[model samples]
Target: MFSATVLWLLLAPAAVSAAPLTALTDCLTSSAVPQLLTTNSKYALAIKPFNLRLPFTPAAVAQPTTVAQVQAAIACGVAQNFTVTPKSGGHSYASHGLGGENGHLMVDMKYWTNVTVDSSTQIATIGVGSRLGNVAQALYSQGGRAISHGTCPGVGIGGHVAGGGYGYISHTQGLAMDNLVGAQMVLANGTVATLSATENPDLFWAIRGAGASFGIITYYKFQTFAAPNSNIVYSYNIQFTAANYLALQNYANTTMPAEMNMRMFITSGGLQLEGIYYGSQSAFQAAISPILSQVGNPYGSTSTMGWIQGLSNYAYMSLTTPIDYDIFSKSLMTVAVTPAAAAAFVAYYQNTARTVSRDWYLIIDLHGGPTSAISKVPMDSTSYAHRNALFKYEFYDRVDSGSYPSTGFSFLNGWVASLVNARKKRGQKADGCKVPTTTFGMYINYADSSLTADQAHNSYWLTHYARLSAIKKSVDPNQVFSNPQAINSK
Candidate 1:
């Protein structure tokens, strides 16, 4: 077999390192290095934070084009007894992607951002580093769009799919991981492998929702759907009293026609309902009429736009909307957790936000259409378990820390507390969802990074925990992949 190092020497001579260095320059030798990174080239190569920045630094960063180079980098780490962390977009909040101070190397996957549309199968083979914006544009050009994360566009496909990505189309399309058909990964042992439903079924099942603990995903084959004809109607519904709760939920639970996607949220303002549909203005009116009637309130705006253009509408005001579609595609930057103190967290953040501003909101999206059905394969067959939820709930705070740290802090606390209180009042256990085990569950991607091992197992595929555990032991027995969000390898 051809050696990975030999292959790397031929493809990227710069990545051919003999001795280590204190900084990235001591190792890199490629011309492509300039093309693959941002201004703080060396700083960008370090994995300083994982929940909190650790005292570690990568010896260097390698931006590889092919999986062979990824394999080579891993092999080098293995040979040098150094840890390797693969990052396409540095969007992780947890330290999962952090390589620490003693780290051997940080394998940058940005150069692998390639997307190919397979009209024959209605599938798109996306490079793991590819951002959502490019994927949307590519699919739009092909006359189709996908169900993916809503706001942050720069989120890399690898982490997004690994965590069961949710987006505006979630109500209709289901989580991002559910749409995956195949994956190419570099194992901890330095093997470049392909896993899919029909191929390495076991690995495929493990990677769908719990991919970070498994391996570095180089590419993903995702199922796509027909592009919508109408523009996204961006609506912000504000209500101050909790009286509108049941009214909003009831309307959302019943009025969601498969043709129209609905997202319902209980915010500090009161109750909010949002959605996007696949039809003419008249049809869109028919779908949301019940919601409009139930709430009896005014809204933000309704405009028609391209599928990608609609995505741009939802960009959070805090982050600059990327002028280049591809730049914004790399969403999922900081993966910070809400403080561990749950009750104090709720009391301070939740109530404070409501008292301070009537605009605090919980966002939801209705997406996924005919192509969004759960696979006939058993629940254990894939990593993603939430295949039935029609809407995805996203709660966020827009307070600026430099100008208003207190407000920002309060907003986060309040936002988290509202979710906790709502779930508790509904009789949900700290570990489980109020929804039944048989039907409803949490989206792995949206799961708070602060969640405990038991909380993750209970909220997701509770029954399959033992199986997933066994798979983790078999593949990563030493727990070399250990991180706060990792599966406990007991």
Candidate 2:
């Protein structure tokens, strides 16, 4: 048998090092795929990460237009013993789109952008490079349809949907992954596989929530909902006060409706609420009344908008909508925030906001209700484990556009610990019952760059981690598709 580095020795110049990167470069050189090496000037712009903090340099960037070229890139990575990762929108919080580390193979999926909807079936098929905004526009224009997705118009649908996408309408519809009918991906050994409920069922389950760990999805087919053209959009600024804080906490724990989706921003300075009500102004008034009555009302306004306008409105909090500010974020999913935990959180937040030289905030989005569509999804149906979460909180702190402060993570880290620890403190009472501290968990989409492989698998997948590992070992025995947080084969 020939050596794996045989091509490296023959094709690569004598000075080039091994692990056969030189061989991989040579293989890509001959393939139809558009290849950009580190030496190339445009490689920097092409591989520029959305999160500037986690920087990386790949062995080469492969921009494949056709299915076969994508296969070709994978085959080359195999021969050269290089790690391969797909770049959909480059919006990974940990910059996993750039391979999350140096000297790996980056498959830039920018050229495969296509959004086609079947007017008859109302099922939409989208390509890997398609952004959320473009997908929403196509869904609305093609068939007056929509899907539950994130607000960032620039986020790539591949990663977003693969990681359990959610938005304001998720309570009414479901997560973006819940909409998927089928998906097409290229596996580690240059095998192109199409997955759905009946086809490659096991792999389908793995990719739906933890897709980035397994393979590169080429496109997705989703069930769509009739686009909501007439909707109520509201914004409010509430004064920071103890009464207001407790009132909002009680309100969050109970009383939210399925049709009324909301997210609140809490900081050391003040509090703001913004979201949509998929109903008329009068109905929205009734839905929002409980919170307003308790908080004693503050500065706010409301307006009606079509589906298109809402996407533009979010463009989500550093991310225009104050943070639209953070260079880092910690996401937590919980069934409910107990009264004690809430009070502890507010007190800590208020106290920290004044002392910390840096700025931080929390965007807690309501996702649970008696009739919430998200909760109805069975825990075993998809790889997404947080199906029953009542709320998803993303904690963020602003780090300016430069090298991240070496010791900058302390504030949010302590903030998360405070809430988790406080949850069990005094057996936190809520609705006359003690709430457990183990309920809240970290999220996968808001990937933290600081976690280890085991920590990430446990944090993101929880009980589903074992099955995902077994599937990873079966499909990707060599582990071609991976990043720092990627699932390891059992």
Candidate 3:
């Protein structure tokens, strides 16, 4: 029992300025779906973004339980000229799931969580609302199968795979997008289409990476691989001093094997190197011997556990603990780490650790080993453009609500910019390694809102922008599905 007049006033400046709120509300309610209005007590929680920096109050939140209901929601929004954003797990760094700005309709897909595995084909048909943890558990329980996805279990598969999902095993198995075989989506015009490399190929390519701007993905069919033997994985955690930063980078650049994945962190406690190997304990020990030789007598720990257990351990999540929404993130893709760049990074880390609270840290992910299979695919085969990077660097900080840093957000921004600049200037080409790189590109899943429109377009899409733009124009001519970093159909 929401008042249309009040809702209209709340959405006065929205894109659907001319549409009647009463008709829009009636259209949605007639479907007998669960809907939350601004007046509803649960509305606030429903619209909350993972990153609190982009707070938004949507006009209404629709929870569609069936594909027909999803179609109804999208059609109603279209007829009412309201923006419709599909939200799953609500994890967009910029909170694009909240419509990026206020007064739009949020189609929350949480009720659509379903994971079915075809034992014969070893394929997983996953709903857009399925989180990585649920999908993994379901797949592992039903059949010993797995998909290469992100580290965070709470991350939604829809957006994750849409933006080229990568995980620890990605170095050997390829990204989540690489395993995507087909998808069913609700387009801007409210039509349902099943797409794959053989059908609606261009749209298939576009949705693989630039999906947020094209349509609402309802489900994905991913090729699954047999789970690791006995679900056992070998992992190691090693601590290092500032002096060993360059040495660690050199090891990652040279001796690190494709069978293993390494992640380095600059934490307040100290610099830590965490690694995971998809092999036996003996193989892992032999693989990391060179690294151990360089950092003699360093503090380290190793363990062997089930794959799911490893994911849970790395995510550091408990049943009662929720992910922190009061956070900011910035990211860049690099081909190589140079001695000069490594030294500068250490200096920046020391300075930031002293200036900021203990909550801030830097994460450097090792990419490109057997993952070159990703590059072997034709560039135009999919919309995910960052196929050449050797590693990815991410800067994460906890910021006070509604208040920028004392020196301003620019302080954090400047640090990221300077570090990227240094890496670009002194780092060697990422070519000649297992990974082939002719240029540079950024990961779109780690979308940075601080980037200008032009910068985001160039960095995320790179050479694929023009083609993606064309597909966007063709599929969503009105640009119904969009966000701050979305592709421009026009």
Candidate 4:
């Protein structure tokens, strides 16, 4: 009876007109355009009202509340013969997630933000638009928690999962893709399907890492763990010289024990290290003392807090406050540098910032507890092939449309590329100081969408675009969910 009722609801006279969006009025049903935009647009768009957005505007935006509603929206888009884009948190730098440049419809998943736990099965069913802050707060209060995610917390799970979410716990839990148990997605053809390991395994495998190119995901299920009970000591701050950077990097590569969740961030200012010890303060101190000795100064202060509080501390240390949607919307860059390295970076950055180009700097965060267990799944099960990884890296820089300098942009990119090449060359010796290829893969979530086909194919040390393309084909034969960074459908 419930199923029939749902079907009836889905079949009800389309509450929204299925007309092609020939004019703005076709999408904005009410005369109140300001209200619609304020109420409907995602965080990034809403946050910076003055942002120079895409030239092509969306005719209408659909805020769906359920899987049926999502299907209905897709059907209406198909019927209207308009292109549609899926928006979770709108963290994407490109216009791919939102309707721009030929796309006429935008599916907003914010209304579907719901998180629930299946106590019996220990699975958490998260809505597509659910953000990390809410997810963490909810789970922590209920004695359940997820592995690390984006620091800001406003990023949506749909895009995160589809692109391969990684966080502080990534080094331990593996990618967020590893914990996803099932998902309910609305396909381009308006068909709704639920995929899991035991059911539709192929689709499940594809969605785990490369789901964005297939459909509009409404809700997803993940294997959850009991939240940590103890208040652990977290040592965090930004202060280190370039001389200490190599030592810190080497320590990160070796000295960090399993009990400590450690991540280092280097930028123009200096080096900041954030670490959380699952055990007591003394235990943490004893475990981390060897590495701290390298810094040659006592840590500024050590605060003890619960897991939830620890998250907040980590946020504060990173200069971010939890759930500040507006700030998070604009805070996209995360790169590494030391005071010694700052001059060169500033020379590149100041010039780029003055120009009208969108390039950003992101740093690698390698913090993981026992919770984020590396995936034991087969390498070929999904397109994401990185099996054993310690950390993932991402960097960003925003540029206004008209102010972008193409030559400056190329120089900045090339400069970074040169630095990476140098590092790769230094680590190339086969026998001594071998850089683990498995650990050398890029984090799919933070990959530059602007990279050419060849770049994306060659960037990751482990996974190749060919394998990713095959997975994309198997899941989305028509490429309905195509985007700049998405695997090409052929």
Candidate 5:
């Protein structure tokens, strides 16, 4: 049996002699390890994080083309005692995929993308490096199938599915992780393991939610759903003043159908309630008639298009330009947005938009309906603990990199925190349409850098934290895979 000290000595680079650093660099550069990118390489920036807030620079980035190469990278990192972080889509808000801090070994998974679909089973085996768009295109083209994933097309399947991905159709099909049937992972000890409900069940559950901490995921097998017939999706964008925000919330809480996803965006311009319905136009109108009747003369429009086309229309990559921006993000899962909370957010957003040059936005995703199978699975069944949340709220603010003054960044961070705090004060907890209990929880995928380890653990896993920690200890006793908010073995 390995003692804790021995495990640290085996896994921690600091515990190893200084000579290994030179050897580690040599080994990485040799033909033995293929597609490795060092700091001085042009592709080094390819490993650069999607989120620029934390400019974390890893010592070297390895772009492994095969599972064997992934194993080799891990083995090298373990032997050299350097921290190794796996980068898939490089979309980590805290930049954990880029070593979180710096001087660690980064295994870039971009070159590993490969998608294969089994038509009879309707299961798609997607490489961890594959982006959401790649998966969608492959599944739709090959099998006419789809799985619930995030809105961002560029998001890597590695972290997205592992962190409990949710998106426009999630209310109907459940989250991306929920659809997971199996996965391939490289454990901390440089061992490749296959995980599923029956195979390595504990590690399977851990990776479904807290994947980054346990191992480097290589591929995911998902139970895909047949695409909706007609491939037609109807969307309505209703523009309203802040005064009407509460009315929209009430409508969403009571009248919205599970098949239709409603996302409310509070922006500098005003409040915009966007609804995407999966069925025909008539069904969409009938389902949303209650809300429409309440709001008089609101500016809005409805359109229908193919499923893939709709995905392209709503793709985050197409909507937002590629520019490095310093950003701060936070999230909350609440029963419903109370009138007071809505009013508070409106006032703060108005003030900030008017006063600062920074761009900020608030998006609320309505959860719960017959389509939301999230409650069908018990909270403890997986590491995703927010199975009972009624809505997911995200607050994001950004300024051009290096443009914000010292005080400017602090102000933006404070504003995002205040929005969540305000909701907590006024919000009531409901267990997936059950009676009110306490305040709501938070989503793990939108990891907040401002949160301490304890705070993040509490927010993401809640009651499941103990079980997740036990699994972390079982799989990664040395804490080889860790970050500010990574699950701790202790």
Candidate 6:
């Protein structure tokens, strides 16, 4: 389970929001789609966020069955000067689908799911409400095709691709956004337009990363590939030493091939290495020999499976089922981890594993090799930065009940600090957490709601932040769509 930095548990929507605006109600009602007010019987469930730790009541929820209805919802929001938000699978880590903070008009996209494959090109067009699993199944069933995206079955495509999806196939095929060719969306001003390199190119560029900040993408088209017929999946466990960690990290950066992708989950016992290799078992063994040498040959399980079966191995839940937990998470994307930083991280984790109060785990995803599709892409080609990132660290923890512990916040945050601050500035006045440059930043998908706007902007996009800000101003001058961490127009 995970949670927001601030907790507003079990608070009724009506208690948190002002009296409903009749103008806004009538506007959405007149559009002929179902609407829910704060007082509605289903309003609480409608506004309930994926992360149970943070529950916020939006001003209203507009269920739009048609694209035109979505436009009307936006129009109503603009007319009332209320913030606009779109909920797709309601899986935003920061609960941005519930307007991040509160009182925004939420447009629920449950009715928008429609998946189809082009007979000629095999490119798949997925609606906003379609989850990653549904999309994958649709493409494969239609034409044995697929796209590179994260392993989560229920992650909504709306945010996943836009935020730069990383998954089993990412090292070879590139991110979900990298394969994306076009989309159809409603602008903040309620203009329903198409996005591609040729049409609405600027908005297209912004959509790849900062999509939610600019508009509600109703449908996304991804350039698909032939789903691999068979794959070798493996899992191994070992108590890795500092040198072993560095050796594996180095292998990930400079030697890992595009045909394979692996990640380590830090358990209290040790590191559990699990991944899917797109190639044959012989090739997989040859590829993994270096890590075996580094870690002294820890034996693990390996097997062959079909494409969809491999996906099922990684799938956790259904598209619509809500997992109840007070979930909290943070992420770091680094260009490189120095030797000192790696050692400090392993040491910190070793100690913290025994004392953590809640159920927590650290997932380290490998990225960047000479032939890596993700790394080969030019950094400036899209708003989704971090093409240079060599590794991604996702820190997740959850409590069964009650507000997230005060101690929980610092635990993961401290672990992240342990790595970044390992390499201190040369001329610091005294010992402090402040460092000249943090070796690691953050990922938008595993969003940290704790940071302020400035910190969020820099951490998510780095140099790409300025350009996104400019596009945000140009496309959404009125700021119709917004959340706490959204790129606000100045």
Per-model TM-score on C-alpha atoms: 0.73, 0.89, 0.87, 0.74, 0.86, 0.93
Clashing pairs in 5: 13-81
Native-referenced Cα lDDT, model 6:
0.81
**lDDT-better candidate, 1 vs 2:** 2
As a TM-score, model 5 comes out at 0.86
Residue range 336-366, candidate 1, lDDT tens digits: 1123322342354345755755333545444
On residues 187-258, what C-alpha lDDT tens digit does candidate 3 reach at each position? Answer: 988789999989889989988888888888899999998877632343344554445655655665666776
How many clashes (backbone atoms < 3 Å, residues ≥3 apart in a chain or on different chains) does model 5 have?
1
Residue runs of model 4 more than 4 Å from their true location after superposition? 1-20, 23-56, 99-104, 144-147, 231-233, 236-243, 295-298, 317-362, 367-372, 375-378, 388-391, 398-415, 424-441, 457-464
- lDDT per residue as tens, model 2, 1-490: 4332232123222222554777787899887778987677776667666666666767778989899999999988888888899999888888889778777789999877898888889888899898888788878888688888988888889899889998878878889998899999999987899999999999999988899988889999998889887678898988656566556555655677778878887776677888888988898999898898777766799999988887677664223221222277788887666677777777777787557766667888776656677878888898988877777888877655334576778777777877788776656576666544336667888988877777777878888888998999999988898888888922
lDDT of 4 by residue, 257-369 (tens): 55566665644444567656666777777867777777775555677777677666655543223221101011111123334343443344344433433334346455322
What stretches of model 5 exceed 4 Å from their correct place? 1-20, 29-31, 35-40, 229-253, 316-324, 369-371, 409-440
| Model 2 whole-model lDDT (C-alpha atoms) | 0.79
The alpha-carbon RMSD values of the candidates against the true structure, listed in the order shown, are: 9.2, 6.9, 5.5, 9.5, 7.5, 3.2
TM-score of candidate 2 relative to the true fold: 0.89
Better of 1 and 3 by TM-score: 3
- As for lDDT, the candidate ahead, 4 or 6, is 6
Tens digit per residue, CA lDDT, model 6, 215-315: 88999998899999768988888675678777777887777888888888886667888889898889999998877778878879999999888988877
- Top model by TM-score, which number? 6
- Tell me the tens digit of each residue's lDDT in model 5 across 46-106: 6555665566656666778887788888888887778888889888887878767767778
Show where candidate 3 strays beyond 4 Å: 1-19, 31-33, 230-255, 295-297, 319-321, 370-379, 399-408, 423-440
Instruction: Please tell me which predicted candidate would have the highest lDDT against the true structure.
Output: 6
User: What is the full ranking by lDDT, best candidate first?
Assistant: 6, 2, 3, 5, 4, 1
